[model samples]
Target chain A: MMQRPPTIKDLARALNISVSTVSRALRNATDINPETRQAVLKLAKEMEYEPNFIAQSLVKKQTHIIGVVVPSIDSNYFSEALSGMTDCAIEQNYHLMICQSNENEVLENKSIRKLLSCNIDGLLISVSLQTKSDNVIKEAQKKHVPVVMFDRIIPGADCTKVIVNEYEGALKAVEHLIKKGCKRIAHIGGPKDLSVSENRKKGYLDALAKHKIPVREELIAHCKSFEEDAIGAIRKVMNAKPRPDAIFFINDLSAITAIEYIRRKGLRIPEDIKIVGFNNDKVSNVVEPALTTVMQPGYEVGKLALGVLIDEIESKSTERQLFELRTTLVTRKSSR
Target chain B: MMQRPPTIKDLARALNISVSTVSRALRNATDINPETRQAVLKLAKEMEYEPNFIAQSLVKKQTHIIGVVVPSIDSNYFSEALSGMTDCAIEQNYHLMICQSNENEVLENKSIRKLLSCNIDGLLISVSLQTKSDNVIKEAQKKHVPVVMFDRIIPGADCTKVIVNEYEGALKAVEHLIKKGCKRIAHIGGPKDLSVSENRKKGYLDALAKHKIPVREELIAHCKSFEEDAIGAIRKVMNAKPRPDAIFFINDLSAITAIEYIRRKGLRIPEDIKIVGFNNDKVSNVVEPALTTVMQPGYEVGKLALGVLIDEIESKSTERQLFELRTTLVTRKSSR
Candidate 1:
């Protein structure tokens, strides 16, 4: 049999005090006298009493539980963001509950409802590619629960959004490739439903337009953001007439796919096909010849998202704040 | 104002039934008549009334929340394991609250205590290298909460343990190098406290003994089970007399570090030096020469751990079961 810790009632009885007084003393409530609070603390310490958090939340009306919803946790970028969030939460004595939707809209909604049922204090989300409904998110706002968006965000949503400057990152990547003497450039776009994909595509097009390099309609291909979809999309781009001298991919996963395809064709990186990718993931550094990509501050985004959400949750105001993070280009052998 | 869903009290008032009956009917309890249950379900569906999980847990004594404590979630192995656990949990309509101790014993104990305060139904833990207290684990057991250990496990504990055959995987990795005509091989060891690391080291020694190759004390180096530590240990082995023909690393992180060191020294892989690693992480494929590794079924360990935990939680009389998963080697360009 396990030895259990003492509860508030047990402490109250041991100290010859009422349960309410014990609770107020534990909470350090202003109504409780300082001498009584000190006495209660000493007894609680001797008893090694750990408050029942669930029972305490019932009266305080706050669980201090934050819900984090993400597309996947396997990627280094997402994991880094989560690490930052957890670090800050630990320092603040808060807890984070993670939910992964696997990029499914239905699953994402289900997770939101579950978080709501748990009475989470706030929510942090990176919208899934398949997410289309704002009903659940709006419902959270109505209940005075703050929502903060990060990475893949929902445009125009009435919530604070933390994001990287995709347009500038793309421009830097394309500029680096052009400086490396690439004339014809191609682009591998991400999933159509995501705002990041559209933003990156716009950045690509603007870079070409700014350089007076005519955009070729046949040079752009919309690939599903993951690994399996990348193979088919890259194959099509490789087979195109006047094959691209350089390519800018929306993400590292698809960028590495293009590199693998180029390698299979006996072509060398930079010498035959220069490439640049967004999200300087671990794969970017591990790949043969390495990869030139844009580095987003995942940890910063995470910390900011939590800080912003916590502020909103406490304020309960409808005002939304949008945070745009700056990104930098990391030059490597792939685009040299 | 936010739209409020009908509560059990509201349903009882409208249907002329007691609040207790309404609550039971909402939960589909057998004690409530089938007609009453159907009526409650019909009304709930029409009115969009979602049951409050906290309120329900208060009465049923089941929170439907599972606590997961891991050393780190950023690694490919742990991430894959978590993915499998999350998939299984979602299928069962259960939610997971994950916490990482980041390899600190104090943090691990704190996380466990916090989870217990939340009244989680069960716990799934992968003990960190710094974890040394069986008392901390026993505390959860005393509360009648089931715990299932995965990957890094403790011995002689009265609980279910799920693990991969680490010794067998290490043996295969060593045998591959021997078959490739490696007469002198080196083994990089992980942290001393972990059971998996000790088992793997033992397997490497056994393989050498069986092959009639005299075990050389100078060929072994121990590192903290992390990439940085492995790099330092590998450097020491490289500087030794009669340099090893091949090095067998404990995991992919260390293997990748060794590869980087070799490249920096301008030595060719498999020609000047041969390398093998365990845990076929995604980095294995991206690295130059494509790392040859033993693949542990991390996802299977996670699924099995959760399944065993749920089984034990549901049945009070069930005996503790140990699950050992099989591992296999994947030959790639590095060892070929």
Candidate 2:
């Protein structure tokens, strides 16, 4: 291991003081007592603690912090993205202040305000499904805080963004199903407002058209959310005038639900109804016949978002950048 | 919808200024321009903004924030728990500042120090598997920051802890395997130093003793981490003197891995060798033959931990509390 430099954290531990206290002493603030300040100074001198060493601690630069807000951390997608964010932040010696929106727009805006009050250097956010306003982004911009959006984002917002290629992923899935001799393919899509949903649905439509298969409006089912709505969507498609030979779901959980529901109806996978899902989650493979899904690369999306945010923060650039990562199809037993 | 009260965020947006600037103006700080302060004061008066309404905004009080550190959010268990923590914290009008340790002790300590520097009111942490010291908690205490541990914890630490009864979960799993008429049972355990590991191992042993099965030390195999070591542990136990009739795993992921491995070895589950795992994760039911495992209420654990931390923070009692939750076994096809 490399020898670490002396910093405010080490001084706080040695002096039995809070890191903020050590910071106050270093800044020669009015609130600190003379004796405490003297002890901190003496200790810093003895230990060769450098105030100019910016990467050592948050206090070294007053703040080397980035604020992040997400819809939820409990979801595998967001959590994996969060892990990637953490890796990049720690590598660059910046700390993260995270807030979860729980898919509520009000909470998302409230979280942004809280982070702004904390004087965050930059902001990173993944918009919640309920988010309908870009007013919060404008407010952040007016405050001179650079902003970056990831995954579930505002379509018209002027900011750096990192997202997986939803359209391509969906197109590939549809093409693979067609190759597997699926003639009448149906889709289970997400809420219409989300870009991911719209893009994927478009891909599904275009792929069907390319294969000389006419789009049947009844074959397309949209769920309000990723809850029991998935089951409702499945029932709607399975009970269609012409039942689909293949089903493509918006996510792995929904696809897994469909698999079980179809099986309970005494249908064999691939033999009765082939299946494909997006976001190659761990459960995609753990399921009985295993799922053929598109890998969203959540971790890469997060890492790239953080890197872009840091670039935007340091460059002071008004020009926005958009990055789209390609998703690969992972074929499994269900699709075959 | 209930009429929402205007707060400093509204004041900031109305004035087209940063939230920090609005906060400074509200405090009558010397740094803000006089005209801006006057504008803010007028807006607050017109909108009936209440500075004393503790729940309205972060500016109302200096801080209503709790710092949280976890090993990794990408895992379903922690993510579900985080969702619970978020629910409780938001309900109680507190924001969360989150940091991920990524299962590194150095990073865990660094994260705790960063949270302390933010001057958080209290802390809720689930220690990383690598965490071995209580020194950081002491440092947090020195700053009057109350902390509560959840999930993976530092045993014997003088603080509130909310954890599932690991011993009970493990015993239930092992007993279920025995009930399936397994004669020679084997176990794939966790790392040696974790209290969770020791408690679970004890449960496995005691369950066998209660069943009057002779102790076979060779049937036990320990893995260092939750990664590929699980496969090695499976190989170790499966190659024992008399290949065990049943395998009890510490967690569901490992048990699934064993299921696949045993099937590849041409062993039929429940017919040749039964299996039981701990933690009824979502994937448990998705897997082939569905895993028989113990249900760990991660979300409940998180909600309870946050509530307890808030109580400790507000009550300011020196007495620490410990909360142990019970686990229920979910019987599935794998063990039957």
Candidate 3:
């Protein structure tokens, strides 16, 4: 037979006090008599009593568990964000249940359903690339579960969000390239449906307009957030009659792929085609020529997203909030 | 009023059947009448019934959830392993609750206790770097919770484990460097207490012995698995009377850091200091002069670890099993 850990009831029985008195004393509730509270604490320590959070959650209707859904965990951005989230979650005495959607809408919906079934107190999500519906998230909200979106989020969703200033970040990246005397700048954007992609595209167009450079439709390509897709986009851009002198990519992964492909094509970076990417992934520093990138605060975004979600969960705040973290351009050899 | 999702009891009341009968029919139990099963399935489809796993766990004494404790998530190795674990777990209809220990023993213990309180059916853990005791793990097994260790495991624990062939992989890496005309090779290893580190160190020494090179104690350095530590160790090794001609690092992170430092000292890779690292992280390819590394099969390790754990959970297998997957040397420009 397994020896069960002593519970509150056992402490109450040993202390010859009411169960409620024991519970309140254990919780250090102000109303509990000081002597009784001390005695309860002493007995609890002597018996090595550990609180049963699961059973307590059943009574209080709060699990103190947050569910996190991400497109994938294999990216440095997501992993760093998760590190920040874990730190904050643990500090707040809450546990996180993490799930990966693998960038599929169906899997994303399934993950949400599973999290809901587990009765998580709240959710922090970065919607999948293929996610087109907010119905599942709305369903969670109907059950009074607060949802906070970060990084890749559902467009126009009535929920709190934490995101980097993609528009400004892209503008700065393109401006840096322009200052380096590179015209005919090509743009490799992410999925058209994604807000970050759309905003970055706008930034590229506006930067071109600011410099009075004509927008060449043929130089712009939308990719599916994969290295292969970026390679294909790069081939198309480089094959144009008047090839682009520079490329501003949606993220570091795409830019890195473009750099490799450009090198394979026997071109020297910055001299042949300058490159700038968003998201200062660690690989950016290690890659040859050291990629120039916009530093998105992934860790800060994650910590702040959890902060907002927990605030909503505990305070029951219904007013949707949006947090936009700033990004900075990190000049490196790729753009120089 | 909030609209609660319909439960099995509600279905039973609406269908004029007992709760147990409704449950059995919904589960498609063999003994349940065919007509009743059809009726339950039809109504369940109509009402969009999703099982409350938390409530179900209370009744069935099984959560169908696996608790995973890892040192950290901000690494390519761990993320890739988690990817594989997620793939296998979802296919097996199990959800994973992941906790990051941040390489702290106290936090690792806390994570285990938290997972235990959640009533997870099984545990998959990579013991933290500072973990010196297996008391918490033993406590879980005392309650009949099956535990499986992987990657960074307890040395002599009776639990099942899955790991890569670290010794052979290190030997191959060092031997390859020697074959490339490197006479003085330095080794930058991980924490001294870690089994993988000890095994890899032995491999390094054995490789040198096989090549008839006298062991020089000054050529080896033990690091704490951080970039700063690697930098410090590299500085010490490079300052020796006769600098090492090559370095075989414990992992890619250390190797990458060494590459950066060696570059800062105006030394060209493969010309001044050839390098070989373990764990072919994505950064290995992105880095300048792309790192040559031993592929440790993190994804396969994760998949196999979960498979063995699930087997133990289902079959109550007590025989201890140690699975060591093969590692292959991937030649790249770093060593060439």
Candidate 4:
């Protein structure tokens, strides 16, 4: 026979006390006598009592669980963000329910619906690249669930958002390459629909304008945020009439693959063509001729997003805010 | 005003149908008339009815939610394992609530208690490095919740466990280095309390013994699974008398740090010191002179562990089983 854990009522019956007294003493309420509280604590420990969060949630109408939806957890960026979120959630006595969309919009919507059905008090989301509409966000709002968006967010959603300054980060990356005396620089961007991709591309173009460099339409390629697509995009940029002397990739994963491709073609980094990437992932440091990239504060963004979401959920605040964190250029062997 | 999502009762009253009929039609029961089913579906969609999983859990006594606890989500190994686990859980119509212990035993216990209170149907755990007792597992079992341990599992837990053949994987790693003519090989191990650390150490010793190599106490270092400690450990080993000509790191993170340390010392890889690591992390490939390591099938382990766990959960099986998955040696530039 399976043994059920001891409950407050069981403790009260065993100790010849009222259930309310047992609960108050176990909670260490000041109104309870010190002796009673101490006895309750000792008995609870002896009986191995575990707190019933579900019952507490029922009374409070708050589960203390936040649902997080991300494109994927396999990447360093997402994992690091999750780590920071976990740290903050634990500190606030909250737990997280995580779901991965695998970069599919349909999966993202399904994840949102599942989380809502599970009675999550709040949500933290990084929308998939293929997400086209804000209907899901509106649905969540209609249900009175507060949401905090991070990294990649819906363009017009009225919610709290935490993001890195992608435009400035991209501009810094390009300016660094231009300062290295590399002309005819090329750009490899991400899916056009994503705000991150669009902002980074704008930075790339504005940086070229600042340097009075001609915009070579042939030197630009947009990819669908996959390694295979990145490979094809790099090849296309390299095969241009006046092949680019340098390249700025939207992310480190793509930049790392491009580095390998360049190496296969017997091209030396910074000497043949310099490279710069976004999201200074750990791979950037480990790769041969370590990559120079923009460091996105993924961990900080996650922490701040959760903090804001909790504030909104608890306080029922309807004021929407946007937070843009800073990004910095990290120089390494690849761009030297 | 916040609007509550429409429920089955709302649909029944609006459609002038019996509540049971409405429920059956909404579920697409075979006995339900086709016209009624289509009408129910259309009304449910128009009313934006979201099923209440919490209420359903109360009635069914099954949450259809699995709780997962890991040491940390920042590492490639844990994230990949989580990916595979998520794939299986979603296929089984289960959602996962995830928590990271951050290698803290207290956090692991807290997470378990919280999950239990949430009434999760089952649990998947990789015990923290600091966990020394099985009280938490016993606690779950007493509550009639099934648990499946994977990767870094507790010894003698009387539960289902999925693990790689660590001893064999380590033995193979050391043997590969020895076969490459490395007469003096060192080891960087993990926390002493962990079963993984103990098993791998045994493998390293047996491999050296099989090769007729003398055991040198000064050449072995046990680290706390961090890059700084790994750096300190590598320095200690490298500074020893008759310094090691090869190193077998317990994991890839440690090995990657060792590679950087060796380079800083101006020693050439494979020529001066061959390196082999356990767990073929993505960083292993990105590192200069890509590392040769043992590939622990983390994804497969996660998938199989969850599969076994669901079977046990559904069947109420009491049989305890241990699954040992195969690990293969991946030779790369560092050990060539």
Best by DockQ: 3
Whole-model alpha-carbon lDDT for candidate 3: 0.86
Candidate 2: where are CA atoms >4 Å away? Answer: A1-65, A177-194, A211-247, A257-275, A286-290, A332-336, B1-65, B142-144, B176-186, B191-193, B215-247, B258-275, B332-336
Q: Per-residue alpha-carbon lDDT of model 3 for A67-90, expressed as tens digits?
A: 999988878889888888888887
DockQ of 3: 0.45
Off by over 4 Å in 3: A12-21, A28-34, A178-196, A213-225, A228-247, A253-275, A333-336, B28-31, B178-196, B213-225, B228-247, B253-274, B333-336
Using TM-score, give the best candidate's number.
Answer: 1
Give the interface RMSD of candidate 4: 3.2
**What local lDDT does model 4 show for residue B25?**
88
Q: DockQ values for all predictions? A: 0.40, 0.27, 0.45, 0.40
Each candidate: RMSD: 3.6, 8.1, 3.8, 4.7
Residue B34 displacement in candidate 2 (angstroms): 24
TM-score, cand. 4 vs. native: 0.82
User: Relative to the true structure, how large is the alpha-carbon lDDT of every model?
Assistant: 0.82, 0.83, 0.86, 0.86
Residue-level lDDT tens digits of model 2 in B1-336: 214345678889888999889889988569999998998889888875655322322233235668889988788888888888877876787767778888888988988876665557898998887777899998788667898999888887889899999898888888887877888999899888688788999999999999999878788999887544588888988898789999888888778767768977899887898888887877677566678898889999999999988888778876788999989999999888
lDDT of 1 at A126: 94
Task: Tell me what fraction of the real C-alpha contacts between chains A and B each candidate also makes.
Answer: 0.36, 0.39, 0.54, 0.58
lDDT, candidate 4, B190-231, per-residue tens: 978678888999999999999899999899999985444577
Which prediction has more favorable TM-score, 2 or 4?
A: 4
Per-residue lDDT of model 4, residues A1-336, tens digit only = 316667888899889999999989877577999888889889999887776665666466677889999998877889889989988987897878888999899988988888888789999999987887889988888888998999988868888888889999999899999999988999999978668888999999999999999999999998985444587889999999777899999888788778768877788887999999888876577555678999988888888899999999889999999999999899998889
Which residue pairs clash within candidate 4?
Answer: none
Model 2 lDDT per residue over A159-234, tens place: 8888888898999999999998999999999978677788999999989988999998888898897644587888
